[model samples]
Structures are given as structure tokens and as C-alpha cells.
Target: MGTVLLAAGVLLWSAAHLFKRLQPAKRAELGDTGRLYATVAIFASILLMVLGYRWADPVWLWPRAGWMIHLNNLLVFVAFYMFAVSGLKTSLARRIRHPQLTGFKAWAVAHLLVAGSVQGVILFGGLLAWAVVSVIVINRANRDWTRPPEAAIWREGVALVAAVFLMLVVGIIHGWVGPWPFGGGA
Candidate 1:
């Protein structure tokens, strides 16, 4: 049952993002409703995935080998860098509105290196697929890649703060937070 829910959540989450590129005029007319539905689907899917994982039985296959863990850390570091630069006003984000999504994919892929389970695969795999597809869609839809230089010191500052916060969270989760539904100490 838990596995089923996790898979369902991933499917729903992917579907919402996949359809986000449908007719611009229609999407505009749908307005907040469309946004709301997308938000709801994303949130609900995530919630369901979490709950399913919490309730599911674990079946770990690969041990968190030293190299895998190191890779995870490396990818996470890159994720933070991508996330930070994407929000900077240095004409970086103009090329990508989905740095956050890229970060998510990195995070998921990194985790998969250490975690091997049906639930883990579904959650991370779904998110990874969504990130890739969304990025492609956005890249295709974008017309003007050029823009005047814009700088927001505050935005950069906030991104730094967020990066620090996320680093701390990762440390806690990976080092202190128990493996819980998984095993072998998180």
C-alpha cells in the first residue's frame, strides 16, 4: 500500500509539471486556478510520498559505500552552488528559471547513490524526471534570452542565507537524523 501511494504521488507530481506548458492563453485565463491546482498537486504528492515512506517497510540493497557518500556530498555542494547562482542578479538566472529544480535533481540523484529502496527510487526518480522535463519545457518556451543587467543584493544575500540553512539541514539529516524507515543510521 505504501509503495502504491508513493508511486501514485510521483505520477501525479509528474503529470502536473508535464502539463504546465499547455496553451499560454488558456493557462493565463485559468489564472490562479491553474496555479492553485499545480500547487495542490505538488504538495499533495509530496505529502503522500512522505507518508508512504514513513509507513512502508524498508529493503535496503546497497550499503552506503564510502565513495557513494562522498559523491552525495559533492553533488549536494554543486546543488548549493547552482541554487545560489541561479538566483543571483548577475544575468545567470536569465538562462535558467529552474535552478532550484536542478538542485532538486542533484539532491535526488545523490541520495539514490546511498539509498536503495522502492520508495526511495520512486520519490527521487519522480522528482528527477520532473526537473529534467520542466527545464526542457522552460528552455523551449523562452523566446528572449537577453535581458538588461539586474542586480538585487538582497536576493543574493537571501540565497546565501538559504544555502547555509540547507547545508545545516543536510548535515543534521545525514549525520544526526536516524535512518528511521530505512536503517543503518542516517
Candidate 2:
């Protein structure tokens, strides 16, 4: 049941995110109401995934090494920084067309490396594929893009602060619900 819910959540997440790109005409027809529906779907998807992961039994396949945890931590931090780059228009923002999606990919890969269970692979790997597909769809829809101007040095500092804050908040939540993330653990 938990695995089923997890799969459902991943499907819902992918479908909801791709609806705009996949069915632009239909999305346009829905107008403002689509935003509301999308918000609900995304929230529900997240909820289902969380609950399913918590309830599901782990079938560990490839066990994570101790050093992988450190690497995961570093990649996770980079992912957060890249996420910030999307909004802050930092250095990499100009080079990367989809900073947010790239960050999502980094996050998924980091989790997959540390995750030993089949369900973990399904969850993170599914998300990774979704992000890749989203990029491809977006590229297909619009081939042209304008590179934004470089942000001021001050914005980099601001972006770093935001990333740190987000990491701290997520770290606290992870510690509360699961294992501690700061120490030598995954």
C-alpha cells in the first residue's frame, strides 16, 4: 500500500508539473482556476509521498558507505545554492537554463546515492526523470531564451544566506522526522 501511494504521488507530481507544458491549450482554458487545482495536487502529492515513505518497509539493495553521507551533504548544499540561483539570478543562472530543475536533479541524485531501499530509488529516481522530462518539454516548446544580466555581488551574499537558512530549516525537519543529517549519518 505504501509503495502504491508512493508511485501514485510520483505520477501525480509529474502529471501536475507537466500539465502546462503537455497541454498548453487545456491549461489556458482552465485559466486562473488551474492554478488552484495545481496547488492542491502538488500539496497532496507531497503529503502522500511523505506518508508512504514513512510507512513503507525498506528493501535495502546497495548499502550506502559512510563517506557517501559527506558527499551527499555537499551535493545537497550545492543543490540548495542552485535553487537560490534561480531566483537570485546568480552566476550560474545565466549559464543554466533551468537552475531550479538542475537543483532538483542534484537533490535527487544525492538522495539516491545514500538511499539503500528500492522505494527510495523509485521515489528519487522518479523525481529525477520528471525533472529531465520537464527540461526537454520546455526546450521543445521554446527554443529561444535570453540570458539575464549578472546580479550584483551583494545578491550573491543574499543568495548564500537564503540557502543556508533553507538548509537549516530542512535539516531541522529531517532530524525531527528521521535521522540526524548533520553528523556522520544518512
Candidate 3:
């Protein structure tokens, strides 16, 4: 049941996100209510995903390796930095058309690297697939993109700092909520 809920949540999330892009006319026809519906669906999907993930039984695929953890840490750092780059609209935004989704893919892959359970694979792999499909769809739909202007150099530093701060906060929260990341038993 938990795995089913998780799968449903992932599917719902993808559907809601892609609806606007895939059916712009239908979305527009619905007017403002479309946005409301989408928001509600997204929230519900998130709730389902959280509950399902926490309650799901594990089916391990592989043994955990020390190197995998280290790699996950590095990739996670890069993922967070990429997210910050997108949010900050730093110079990187000018070059990377979809930094946010790219970062999301990175984050998913980082989790997949350390994930041995069936639930973890489904969650991360489904999200990763969604991100990949979204990128392809978006690129095909809009071939021409107006890149953002070159941002100030200081903005890059701020983004880096933001990434570090976010990583620290997330690490602490993750440790408290789940397994302690550093040398702690899961």
C-alpha cells in the first residue's frame, strides 16, 4: 500500500507539472482556477509521497559502500549549488537553460547512488525520469530562449554561500529526521 501510494504521488506530481506545458490551451481555458487546482494537487502529491516513503517496507538491492556515501555527498553539494544558481539567476542561468531541473536530476541521482531499497529506487528514479522528460518536452516546445542578462559577480558568491548554508541546514535536518549521515547507523 505504501509503495502504491508513493507511485501514485509521483505520477500525480508529474501529471500536474506537465499539464500546464502539455495542455496550455486547456490550462488557459480553466483560467485562474487551473492554478489553484494544480497547487492543490501538488500539495496532496507531496503529502502522499512523504507518508508513503516513510511507511514503505524496504527491499534492499545492494550493500552500502563507504565510497558511495562520499560520492553522494559531493553530488548533493553540486546539486544544491546548481539549484542556488537557478534561484539566484546568476551568470550560470545565462548558460544553462534549465538549471533547476538539471539540479533536480542531480539530486535524484545522488540519492539513487546511495539508495539500496526498492522504495528509494522508485522515488528517485521516477523523479529523475520526470525531470528528463520535462527537459526534452520543454526544449522541443520552445526552441528559442532569451537568456537572462549577465549577473553581477557578487551574486555568484552569494549563490555559493546560499548553497553551503542550505546544505548545512538540510544535512542537520536530515540527520534528525532520518539516519545520521556521517558514520551513524541507518
Candidate 4:
């Protein structure tokens, strides 16, 4: 059930992005509605997965030690920083227009290292695969890899702050919420 929900989330998420590239006209037609549906789909999928997780029994396949979770968290922290930078008009985005995608890959990789359950594979593993494929597809479709614009220093500063905020949030969740997706208690 968790795996199904995870796959559904991935498929919905991928379809949402792929549609924009493959059928821009259709996407424009729906406009905000399209976005709304995509958002709903994503939320629904995640909600279903959460329920499945709570209901199903855990089966650790290749669990990593809790100590190594710190490494995974660090990697995810870097990815979170990249994700923040990618949203801004920083040189990072210009150089890597797909910083979010790359960050997603990094995040997925980090999670994969710590998560070895069937649920983990379906969620993080699927996301990792999607991120890699999406990056390649986006690059091929754009055919333009121009350098990104340099945002104001203040904007960069804001991004840095946001990254730090995200890291704190992740840390809190990992420590207090009991990392079910990835083994907790380090």
C-alpha cells in the first residue's frame, strides 16, 4: 500500500511536469486549475502513503546504523541549500537551470543511503530516478544552457537563511517525529 501510494505520487508528480513540456497548450488551457489538480494529487498521494505507513508493519531490508543518518542528513542539508538557491535568480540557477532537480537527486540519494525498507525504496528510490530522468529530459528539451543571472546580495542572503531554516526543520522532524521513512535515533 505504501509502495503504491509512493508510486502514485511519483507518477503524478512526473506527469505534472512532463505535461508542461509535452503539451504546453493544454497546460495553459487549464492554467491555475491544472496546478490545483497537480497539487491535490501530490498531497493526496502523500497523505495516502502516510496512512499506509502507519497501518502497515515495518520490514527493514538493509537498515543502516543510526550514526550514519547524520551523513545522510548532511547530504540532504546540502541539497536543501541547493534547492533554495535554485529558486532565486542566483548564478547557481543560471549555471544549473535544473538546480531543483539536481537537489532532488541529492536528497533522494541521501535518503536512499539511510532508507532500505520497501517503503523507502518506493518513495526515495522513485524520486531519485525521477529527478535524474527529469533533469536529462529538461536539458534536452531546453537545448539552451545559458548562465544564470546574478541576484542581489540580499536575495542570496535570504536564500541562505531559508536553507538554514529548512535544515532546522528537517533536524527537528528527524529528532522529534521519529524518522519512520529513514531510521531515527542517532
Q: What RMSD value applies to candidate 3?
A: 1.3
After superposing candidate 1 on the true structure, give the runs of residues whose Cα lies further than 4 Å from its correct spot: 90-98, 147-162, 173-186
Look at candidate 4 and give me any clashing residue pairs: 94-148
Per-model TM values vs. the true structure: 0.77, 0.95, 0.95, 0.82
Candidate 3, lDDT over the whole model: 0.90
Which regions of candidate 4 fall more than 4 Å away from where they truly are?
151-158, 180-186
Q: Please give, for residues 1-186, the per-residue lDDT of candidate 1 as tens digits.
A: 888888888888887777668467776788999899889998998888777777778777666666776787778766876688676643456555667787888988987887777677877877788788877887788854665367665776667677777776767775553442223344
> Which whole-number lDDT from 0 to 100 does residue 2 have in model 2?
89
lDDT of 2 by residue, 92-170 (tens): 7889999999989999999998887988987999999999999999999999998889878887788789889998999
Work out how many backbone clashes candidate 3 has. 0
Clashes of each: 0, 0, 0, 1
Ranking by lDDT: 3, 2, 4, 1
Q: Name the 10 consecutive residues with the lowest summed lDDT in model 2.
A: 177-186
Give Cα-based local distance difference scores for all models. Answer: 0.73, 0.89, 0.90, 0.74
Tens-place lDDT per residue, model 4, 79-153, is 987888887766566666777877888888888887777777777887788788777777787896777666677
lDDT digits (tens) for residues 1-186 of candidate 3: 999999999999999999999999999999999999999999998998888898899989987898888788778888889999998899998999999998899989988988878988889999999999999999999999999999999989998999888888998898998876554565
Better of 1 and 4 by TM-score: 4
User: How should the candidates be ordered by TM-score, best one leading?
Assistant: 2, 3, 4, 1
